[model samples]
Target chain A: MVIMRRVAAGLLVMLLSMMARAELVVEVTQGVEAPTAIAVVPFGNETGSALSEDVAAIVQQDLQRSGFFQPMARENMLGFPVQQSELYYRDWRIAKMDYVVIGRAVSVGANDISVRFELYDVLREQSLLSEQVTITRDNLRDGAHFIADRLFERLTGLQGAFSTRIVYVTAEQLAPGKQRFRLQLADWDGARARTILESSEPIMSPVWSMDGSKLAYVSFETGKPAIYVQYLATGRRERIQSFPGLNGAPAWSPDGSQLALVLSRDGNPEIYILDLQSRQLQRVTRHYGIDTEPSWAPDGQSLIFTSDRGGQPQIYRLELANRKLERLTFEGNYNSSGRLTQDGRFLAMVHRSGGGGNGFDVAVQDLKTGRLDVLTRSGMVESPSIAPNGSVVIYATQEGTRGVLAAVSLDGRVQFRMPAVSGDVREPAWSPYLR
Target chain B: MEIRSYIVPFVLALGVHAAVLALLSTHWMGHDEPQRKVPRHIEAQMIDLTALARREAEQAHIAEERAREAEQAQQAERKRQERVAAEQRRQELAKQQAEAETKRKARQEAEKKRQKEQAAQRAAEQKRQAELEAKRKAEAVERKRKAEEQARRQEAEVKRKAEAAAKAAKERERKQAQAEAELKQALAREQKAREAAARQASQAVIGDIQSYIQAMLQNGWRIPSTARNGMEAVVTIHLLPNGEVDQAYIHTSSGNAAFDNSAIQAVYRVQRFPRVADIDPILFERRLRKLSVKFRPEGLRW
Candidate 1:
């Protein structure tokens, strides 16, 4: 055990040394304290055909949803300027808009349109971006999203995640005794949803790999819980883990070289680290008390899992090489489902309040300070997933018995809910930064 | 009265006798021959002598008596003339003697009056000299008395003044010592109070400077949306004495670009902090010149 611990220390030293120097990550929950003002004027239709989608409105919504921009409402716009000659910068300045976007959508053919947009820096009174792209009628939304992404990146000096996708599981009650579960993938705004799988069995714990091209989850289809990895683009899937007692809680390692999972094959639930290349399983926990729900740390040097060894289920960190386990959480009696943030600075988990409530709520804790914060007052919350920027956390919550996905910024200041779909949605998995 | 009666009788007798002599001389000369008449009368006289003697005795006696009377009268007249001459001489002598006596008495009285005036003058001179001597003696005594009195008074005054001077010196020395002691104590107390006041004043200045900086930053900061409720950015800012921002950069970012930029922008917006410039240079350099402020947008939570 001592030699193994030494190896683990060496591994940690090597891994930490190889990693880039991490900047201090301060959790910000409050949306932009001063959201930048922007004006998205409706584009002039020179083609004279009735436009199906309001491209400017779509772009305005995209920027507004990011919480970093405050888009002026259409009624608030003083003038609609499509051409450079008609752009009265003083009008936008009077409207308190820092930037303005104007464009004209010209229908080139029956199926194609030429969309040209010019972004104006109203404060500086200069054109920031001018671009023209051809698209079909259905591609107008996509084109608008592209414009919003460009504007966001230019103004905030950070890459825009507006064009990203999110996959979630939804369950619909069909008959008196039957329920249908669908694994759905959709745009960031829940638009353009496409189902990848549908089954009557329950689906739980859907997680995306680091590349955002594959998803791993557990399904109760074979009369037992099994972990399956599915290729998102090809609809190809394979059952990766199916043990004697329990096979669930699949988490991908940072490099996609391994998966940390919980297995009960040895008569008790324990965490196991499976090497993806060698198909080798390594037991990471030896506690007789139940150990489950293993998640990989960002550096992949360790894994955090839930265990009931000391008493109630609490989170523990296990160094992979030496199998050294350390208790990470002591704030509450029941702290489980630990999910590490992208920066490895915080852990979002299912925490039960000390007042002995019947349900658990989403909570986050600073790993360095041992400070815990209960983020949600509403009970019965679970599946907390951090966004790619580590600024927000999306979780599955119940609102009057209807499961809905809600997102809260890490500091718990900004909270919003996704539009309700056709059925109850849960287990939301935010995609990584897209290429 | 006898002298006046004699003067008239003598004048008459002389006149009669002169007349008789003239007549007799005239008659004799005229009658040179009458010389012979006397012889004739002589013869008658003898006859009558007896008759005359008898008559004379009566007459003679008368004559005799007459003769005797005549003889007696002649003798009486001679006696009277002698008496008169003698009386004249005696009267002359008596008059001369009386004149001489009166002259002598007058001279004697004049001499006496002169002698009395001389004596009186001599007595007045003596009295005046004596009075002068007495007055000189009295003046000497008075001068001596006054001198003695003045000397006594001077001695007493000198002794009294010496004692008063000694007492005054002692009192002045004691007062001077007390005053020096009080002044020393007062100086010490004043020094202590001054030090305490300086300390309190400097502390107040420090507080004011801090409050000014905080207020300026509050007005200057525009917290970005990326700043969370608890997000903090520690920015080190360098400033000039005139309250101008010389340099401001993040010592530690809150890992949010917008948040860090917002903090930096706040520092830039203030441009200068005149409050810090108002503080003491030494204290400012020690505590406030290069200050690091932690900005937390705690109120920004929705």
Candidate 2:
């Protein structure tokens, strides 16, 4: 029952997300300054390696609640060095602090972690951005929001949405308090909430880091449920093969090295791509049965999931180097999570078939022609986030049982909410636009 | 050269000192008999005849017409000597009547001389003489003495030459008509006494020129009353000789600069006038020397 963490890559995993030999000195242009200031520190795991969360403090409260930064607070740090020679540079230019993020988390083995970060320019004392990301404390909050979206695009020249990935849900105490169902691994704003696996039994699909840093979840911890890779700074973890019947969906690989998951391991659920420099998990899908949500394609050469092999749940596009699969959504019978658009051109999903109470809204299809754009007006809208200049949208629904963390502007004018201090704030993850 | 040169001789010792210049020149050094008693009363001011009584009455009427022409030339020399003696007594009576008429006719013709010596001759003859002789006696007495002898010799030569030429012509015609009527009544009484002495010398030369112009016009002539005639002025008076007016000249003008300034303010309001008899000394230059004043106001006229 997990939904939404959809990323469908195609142009060959967007040319293997670089390192055709490695050095491509970046140049993606266009206007950048929307709400975008990012400072994210605290990744130094050293080796104790139990990163439940804190990937640079969940990418600095996800780029400071995305209202664009005035963020230098961490108790007013002028120079917080974890490496790069513990930089000084006039104490961040006497604390004016334009950019000075730092990162560490070393112990690269048993629970795997090699996260190195540097992002300076405290008034030009050099080093605009450096990176070394290898995460396993189940993907150190997706490698600390993927080096905070590449040091928020190298000190704000823009596009470092602190590497996107935030899938929240935290109902932390079962007795002392009341919430017993939570789902949260925050990095896009709700800071370092690192419970990659807690539940009164329920969790959902949270997939990211094809350069966003990391996530991929759907956890009932492991009862009749499975699928996980949790490290957001250093609380280590991983579990990508729970089988017996329909494992769940998990997407990544625009090159955080690969993972487009949803697996019954093989008899029924489909889609897979787990490379990690060749830990090699390939099986694109042979569909002898219903397929589940599997997204990628920011150019990981094709993959868009949720398939009932054409009978009900639709939306499919496979082509990961000729494992050619097609049927990409037809009208709607019950479309599920389909997040594509970082300009692969539109997909935001979850438009269930309307009939009874005209339920589940939030739509938007347009991958060049299959137009939809439904956007919500009343109730159950969920998990949306497409800002970083894709023009606003942040989501989590249920206004009545009150899980509230809404935001919408993708042309439905503007709706809002960031609510929750008490109870029902459910699974809401909207990350991407940072740097 | 110092000390005031000794005070300049003590101030010249109180003014030159020559005994005060001999006590002011000769005061009484030679007084002489009261200076001959005041020049003898100024020599009695010699011009006496009561100050020439009309120039001695015109020199006594020109010396009485030169003594009446020397008394008519002595009555014409006494009638020219009585006509030369009656012409010498008529020449002596014609020399006695011419001798007695040539002797009385030679005595009557020698008496009828012989009277009739002849008468007779005739009768001579006859006389018869005697007879008639008597008749004739009468014829005879003859011529009677030849008429008494020629009347006695013509009456003695006519009575002696008519009584001596009638008494010398009757004295020469009574003295020549009494000397021609006494020389025409003495030339009509000397032409009526020379017209009464030129009518009393022109009435005594008009009564001494009208009492010396009424005693120099008795000098009371004033005429001020703010003097108006044709209002002339020109004043400048300056006088003193007692007719005072020390300074006057208000310059009255008639070229009418305000009626010659009111006739120079009426000759300075008639400073002093009253004295012009013999006019004191022509009154300091004939009085009112500068008075060209003309404001008549009808005062003094001719």
Candidate 3:
């Protein structure tokens, strides 16, 4: 009986230790004080042949998705040497890159290849790891993600699950008045795309729940646009918001407790904070002009929202306390789609330029510098969602014939397009930093 | 008993982590100086080249004074040899010219003696013998001889004296030509040297200007070391186009007076950092005109 107790105690000890190690893994409740800086240069090709997956770019997307590594754009890369020996640390340091990654692929066979990669700590001036692996052509995308996962773990001290997916909406014109729409999800780097929903009506604003398991999006299936939360695993969906007038822009609150959206049942389109538990709605903003596109700040105290109350669709801030509303955007004649940084120090928004809509760009305003940086010179960008690290944002835009998801770094260095294989994909919302 | 056994390892890990965190956060006093290390510039450069960056961490740095001394010593050696060789060549040319002048004077005296012997035969007889009979012929011959002798003497004197005079003239001309060439060369060398020196000086000045900007930025950043975690503040900053701060407000308080002041001062201290002077003022105003800044002392996520 005494021996049995001892054995049981050892077993219990083993189990508890396992669980305790996972305690730090509990969704990283406390993020790093200073967000890491990562420089993701363009992936180099192997000497023998060309590769289908731009592995470097995919790796960049995977790292950027984690919201731990702030990816520096290839355009901003002063110098990118393929081999570790050729890497010039000064160039990266000048760009304030904390870590720099270089990679290349070698064709082992007609259908097989060995991809090689390394992550270097620019400040520490050391290669964090030399993780090299070989894979078939079918698994090249997985291989790129695997490298990203390893780097993410070493730097952010958290495991990265970006080898997963992205679900979004794509729209197209079928005829003069009729339009075709499709709901789609793809690999994190925009490969292996498949359609989830297809319709003639418009589908927009696809958002992922805290866990990447569920989605809440705006679908116009029932003759009018209504908000629906769908479970990806069981293909189960429940309409969360449906009203007579305008029912649009449904964004899930950070805690998954409530949703902040825009509705016209109150006569004008003002922001209404909906309680997910009680199904009770509280009006957050009351304005004459259009008040829409509400996004939650890191702390749930206040929400940064878009309103034209001061004239034009500009961003406005509403303090949940006393429900006081203040105009947040006054610099731009036309600014919309305001997304706050996780720290709430920076406001990333779309700035409209030129007379009568000739030019538009995505801009970032450092609240500290009072400095505005135009992140996207590209004309088409909508629904820009900043990553948890405030480094990059993914938004909806027209790419060729389809509406695809593209990302722009807040610092204006990196740009990427995620186009699905079937139908058009748009309105990409990056998930909060996943555990 | 079960809890007791679990407590040891748990406590040990926690203690080690806490100790390390404390050590890191405490700002250990003496470790601030990275001695026996490479220069900061070299350290900064090494990041680019993997091997070199690694090398920078390994090598012990030579003192600045010793390196400067070695460079100055090399320059001194080069100047010493060039000056000594120039002085030796000047002395050798002067000695050779003195020996040649002595030889030329002795040769001129011997030539005058040979001309005197040749003119002695016709000297006395031509005065009385041909007083009247050959007066015409004598006068003609005497005139022709005198003319020929005069021409010979003039030719000899002109050739030999011309050689001496021309040599003097050539020497003077050579000296004048050399002086002009030396003056031009000196001016050209000086001009080239001045330009090179100017280029170097300007480069240093540019570097100083950049360092001054860096100093201003570094001093301006001013994040207080004592800022505790869970620090939350809302700062609203207004901007002018061209990315300059027009005005800033501490819209939300972080609780700590010093921290809040530091945050406000950092923007002011920037003095014009994130300098986007080249961007269109209109675009800067439109996009980045007004913004809010928040800081969390404890990590932001929960």
Give the best candidate by TM-score: 1
The complex in candidate 3 yields a DockQ of 0.01
Candidate 1 error regions (>4 Å): A1-38, A43-51, A82-136, B1-220, B228-256, B260-302
Question: In order, what lDDT does every prediction score?
Answer: 0.75, 0.54, 0.65
List of chain A TM-scores, every candidate: 0.83, 0.28, 0.70
lDDT string for model 2 (A246-343, tens) is 66767776657777777775666777777767668877788686776777767667888777766677777888777777776777577776667666
TM-score of chain A of 1: 0.83
For candidate 1, give the docking quality class from DockQ: incorrect
Against the native chain B, each candidate's TM-score is 0.36, 0.19, 0.26
DockQ of 1: 0.05
Q: Score the docking of each candidate (DockQ).
A: 0.05, 0.00, 0.01
**What does candidate 3's lDDT look like per residue over B1-302, in tens digits?**
34346546856975896688568644642343352132222111111336543543343133223435665775555355335534543453354344444444444443344334323323323332344337547646765775576576557656757877798899999999999799767855775575467446644543443344334433443333224456665566665655466775687787765455445544453535354454334323333355555544443221
Each model's TM-score, in the order given? Answer: 0.58, 0.20, 0.46
Per-chain TM-score of chain B, candidate 2? 0.19
Cα-lDDT of candidate 2: 0.54
lDDT by residue for model 2 (B1-302), tens: 34336445644742454345346423432343253344321111222435344654665466445545654774444234223322322342233233334334544454444444435543553553453454346435544554565455445434544544564566666676677567545544553464356335533533443343223312322222122234444445454555445554444444433233323323333334444222424222322333333333332110
For candidate 1, write residues A297-324 as lDDT tens digits: 8888889989999888899998887878
- Please rank every candidate by lDDT, starting with the best: 1, 3, 2
Q: Which stretches of model 3 miss by more than 4 angstroms?
A: A1-57, A60-126, A130-140, A152-165, A174-178, A353-358, A398-404, A419-425, B1-302
